[model samples]
Target chain A: MSTEIATGRDIALIDLLDRLLHGGVVLAGDITLAVADIDLVYVGLRALISSVATAEENGVPLP
Target chain B: MPEADDARLARLKALLAASAAEDAAALLAEARDAAREEARSILQDVWREALLEAAAAAVEPRPPPERRRVRQEEGTAVVEPQPPEPRSVPQEGTAAVGPRPTEPRSVPQEGTAWWAYCVVPAAEADRVPPNLDSVDPSGPVEIVTCGELAAVVSRVPLSEYGDERLREHLEDLAWVERVARAHEEVLEAAMSATTIVPLRLCTIYLSRDRVEALLEDQAPGLAAALAELRGRTEWGVKVFAPAAAVAASASTEVAGGSAYIERKRSERAAREEAHQRTNECAQDVHARLEREAVAACVNPPQRREAHGRDAQMLLNGSYLFDDERRSVLESIVEALAGEYEPLGFSIELTGPWPPYNFVLPSASALS
Candidate 1:
């Protein structure tokens, strides 16, 4: 019951990360620092990412 | 130098000296008058002109126009009118203007890494915005070109972005927010000027050479991605079922026990019918959007815990379209909104962003 509407230009942190971390042209390289270890980091960020996502969904304005 | 040229040089030196002295005094006075916006603007103009004159005087003794043009094209000259400079200035003036003149290009001492923002075709290398602030404010964004691709990159301290330190930073929500915003800011600047393949967040390399090597190694794949993204942009569309209205419609009552039982059964049936209708509506919307989009992808519906909304997400889709189709897609969204709003469902449209979803190889292909 809490889903909120969002426009394309909103530039919300959740949306940015959704496109930035979840999508984009990724090239695997030895020297390039990959987000490959993201799983390890995501475990720590799950709470925050989820909260922000929830905030966006609930129409709560993020600071 | 000729006698007349020597005399002109002397005159310029005298002017510069006078302006330098006057500038110091005017700067002090300008500080006192800072409260007055009009006075501050006039002082800024004077300072700009003085700086320009000094720069012109310094370059006066250089070769004539033809030679200077050649040098500029060769990338040795610093004073040429660069096209990307103007666009690099933050339009909102919230952030500091582009990089400072003294910003370091690279740090080779060691324990430093290069964070690459995006890549553009080598032909558009000159279009890369200069003086852009990167995730590391201390480092300025620069381009590393290889064959046909140029990587937009900035140098960062490895101690901060190295595997361990970066992993730690990512855990800090505030830190992640700042770095992610900076990354997008640089991409937005580059996107405005050229077709770019935005690298994923936190993409870093050991050095500039490594970035160039990456460009060389990934040339084929990168080229294909760029070709697919040419003249196209990504848009997002989401549909939500209005929980309150749907809940209200599902609520009903009857007085008698037999009537109540019958009413409950019919209510369950009606609710099931509405759910099916909602699913059908979502599918219809996606089908219509796909027809107008050059490429389309449907993302999994977000969970309620993640979105913090009680409403169920019926659709989450991204579309890629050409520039001219922007209005067409917009109108379609408008029509969809109008048609669905009355059915206890709402549609939201977003984009014209870089083709983030379309350029990447599909997950199945990668697997």
Candidate 2:
């Protein structure tokens, strides 16, 4: 367990974009939405598994 | 036989508990009833506030000519053209985009309406016609706009899984997929124009008025937000390292050896040391790359069982950059490839996606 603060600037723009694009205040509106019959969890899991599998199959080396 | 019977009983008990606990039908019924009551309460609380805020807020009177739009070109649907007037500053940016040319109206939902939304600027409000792209686009896209805020409402309800009867028969994986797709559609539509504020899954608004009021309440903040987000786009970059290759590199980097046993042990230690160093290198690469980009976010890297591949995912990163700098960013990534080639790691960048993670509540709404 190393307690350290790395002090070197000059970070990449992509990294900044990642935070600016994906990180923020999520406003969950007070509205109930009807969604399709399929499940979101399964979709995510399946996508994850298949993408990994595809990577392996395509020789991309799954991590 | 007795042990097996006990296990079966335990399974049954678990099933019974789930039925009582998370039954979708009961939850939906409860939520449905609650939404109705909550809707009324929200209306009551905000109705007065809405009127007061709209009056106090800077409600620019319509500049008549800016309201008329050039019709969509033949066969090519286009988002709103650049605001007819040019303004360099923030306050002026508000005037540049202007207000919704027409008042928003509600279309009735036949059965249950599930709210699906991807946030777009109020300027692109007209592009999302009501009931436009519902699973069956047979109807108009149920669009409701307020100032610079727009939500493409869908009447399709997500299937309830909490009901014991249906839960037993339901394919949960299938249900989530359908909902995600609905989310995707709205998000895709939003991405086509400006950075969209993606609403969470299964959010439903009972009436169009609430959305209008919401827009009214959040307008000033949303307007400023639109100005901030107008020109930028998002991209993703993930860095992965092959575990086997890392291990191999480690073994090959062994230092001096004396006795056979000591030498063999030293080789193993050397491999572990090299592996740790490689992991560190991978992290540095991602962190440095992110720091160099315009804006970047590093999400928790997901770990899974090694899939007989030589790689370990060291970083999963998303980036937001302006279009002009897309190539500049890509070049930086290419440069990283050259630098980290010796470490047996690779950086994969994918995107130009909607700013799904960057949606913020209008700041004025907070004040």
Q: Which candidate is the best by lDDT?
A: 1
Per TM-score, the best of the predicted structures is: 1
List model 1 lDDT by residue over B205-253, tens digit each.
7667767876776777777667666776778887876674235332333
Residue B93 shift from truth in candidate 2, angstroms: 48
Q: How does residue B273 of candidate 2 score in lDDT? A: 59
What lDDT tens digits, residue by residue, belong to model 1 across residues A1-63?
A: 001111223575656666776666555422222334444344445677677777888999999
Candidate 2 lDDT tens digits, B1-367: 6999999999999999999777877989878865664464356335433432222221122223212111112321112212122312222322211111123322232434435465567677666533335532333456677766776665543233112212222234444444445445555555554555555444444446756665565555445555555665656666665454334322332333235336545544654555565556556665666565555544544343322234655566555566667667788888888877656666776655555444432211222
Window of ten residues with lowest summed lDDT in model 2 chain B = B68-77
Model 1, position B88: C-alpha lDDT score: 25
Task: Give the DockQ (2 decimals) of all models.
Answer: 0.13, 0.11
lDDT value for model 2: 0.46
lDDT for residue B338 in candidate 1, whole number 0-100: 88
Give the Å error, residue B180, model 1: 1.6
Fold similarity of candidate 2's chain A to the true chain A, as a TM-score? 0.37
